[model samples]
Target: MTSWLKAAAFGVGGIAVAGLATLVAFQERLVYVPVLPGLPRAYPVTPSRFEIDYEDVWLRSSDGVRLHAWFLKHSPPVAGPTILFFQENAGNIGHRLDFVRMMMQRLHCNVFMLSYRGYGASDGHPSQPGITIDAQAALDHLSERGDVDTSRIVVFGRSLGGAVGSVLAFNNPDKVSALILENTFTSILDMTGVMLPFLRFFIGGSASNGPKILNFLVRSPWSTVDVVGKIKQPILFLSGLQDELVPPLHMRLLYEKAAEKNTKCLFVGFPDGMHMDTWYSGGDRYWRTVQLFLEQNVPRMIDGKLSSKDEDEDDGRDCLQRL
Candidate 1:
């Protein structure tokens, strides 16, 4: 090759190497967004504001990382089904109080939601392995609680939380009664290409034949697709067709895989629902779908039928409005 061409080629190669190194070194920052812009780590609101009975909880992960959570109860003796919520990547569990309140009001089930290690009041940085440990700790805590019914534990996760919840359910099939995944991607390996289209060229083929180094650079490959097939529990997939972050196709892939193993696999797609606004856009239909799924799969749980009273009572008012 000519001298000028060779220099240009060398420069491009060096830049590519540097870019790959940067991604490998700091990829966690991009994956786990504990705090969004203008959103503080401190909770903006809590279940108490909505008059919902809740307890501030702290549990230690297997690695001894302190994790923060809120255990919300329907009435008193928390004997029926429980919904273990796993939040999206951008914020802490506190941001989901409204959803928790609605679930309790409509479903009459206990809710347990925890901030993974490194998010909110939880200790340590978030990584795939570390968050996995954190999820296990949360489940262990629930299992130990006398108020919780270990048999009817339903795991509900959104976005990145879906991947985390999937891992937890795959690991403990007997412990989890059902799983709900919303706007979740198939895997970090798949999401890398979706978020960064150029990477598709380098990581398209099968694992055995694909560029091994490019795959290695994916620090946190929370491969939900790899484990959903192994989860024998009932699973409900909520996909927002208009989800800008995670394409609706990802949810389809997960549903297909899970259906192969579990007959109770259900998929619901919202035509106008976006990544973060599916609950809002889906209106009563979204909640009804969830209620029906839970009722059908998880026997003896409190009725979650979305009634007009449930709609008029708290649905209209913001959770921040304390009565």
Candidate 2:
């Protein structure tokens, strides 16, 4: 072979090798692992200085899938909807035990939180589909409980949980009295790309999207515009100016897309609030916003009991608008 031809061949081979290496290493988001296809897991539930209080509960999904959940009850039941707390993507419900403790102290209702299939003691691996099924299983479990008021049940999810909650609330509109989304993006894809200005372009590539490739990191099942419109339930969205996981503007876009003009859609954007703890750091205003929402939307019936469901004020639409 000629010297120039040989050099050209070597160059092409080097490019091929580099590209293949990049493809293999980043194809599944490098370090991001799917929580599903995994087995039973557990994490420590750390409370605040008060030793975050909670009750251990186990429930099975429809497919006989077992899930671990934490039920945080408020003493002296007040007339309000029971909160089914769906958390963000992280270790487990145990990680947010401190937040649960604060919820119990502030809100005058019950709070139950469960881990996705792979996190905590919940059985089965986690996937977008798996989490949806498990959420339904959670709803089923709550429905069977004699103490739970079906009409006054509230579905609350933060970040990734918002996608899960939106799907559940959309399907069973009648079942969900209201919805509360905190630091939640419109969809997983939106969460990873659209909301992330710096890394938005990396959705199709890797090494750039380190831990967001395979772990339910595709098109998210939750479409806030669709879900919020279909369900007549009251909705409240909370977000922070500095929530890195699920950017603040995304929350604003979600608010604008909501169809109902007077959907009772409220936003509580804290000037200095952090991600999940916007409520924690915002102090009285944060808790009051939530309390006021629950008070207005999930007010008592003639018997004085539980019932029903943010952020900025940005006016815009999401890509889902095309859908």
As a whole number from 0 to 100, the lDDT of residue 60 in candidate 1 is 91
Give me the overall lDDT of model 2. 0.67
Instruction: Highest lDDT: give the candidate number.
Output: 1
| Residues 152-251 of candidate 1: C-alpha lDDT, one tens digit per residue | 8999999999999999998998899899999998887777777666476564323223464578778788888888889988888999999999878888
Q: Write the per-residue lDDT of candidate 2 for residues 1-323, one digit (tens) a residue.
A: 99999999999778656654564455333212323235334465333335544567787777777878766656665555688888877657766777776777787777778887877777776666678888887787777777777777899888778878888987777788889888877655544454334345434222134544343445333455445555667788888888856668877877776645535677768888777678777787777677777766776675564333223522122211111
State the TM-score for model 1. Answer: 0.86
Candidate 2 matches the true fold with a TM-score of 0.74
- List the lowest-lDDT window of 10 residues for candidate 1: 314-323
Instruction: Find the candidate with the highest TM-score and give its number.
Output: 1
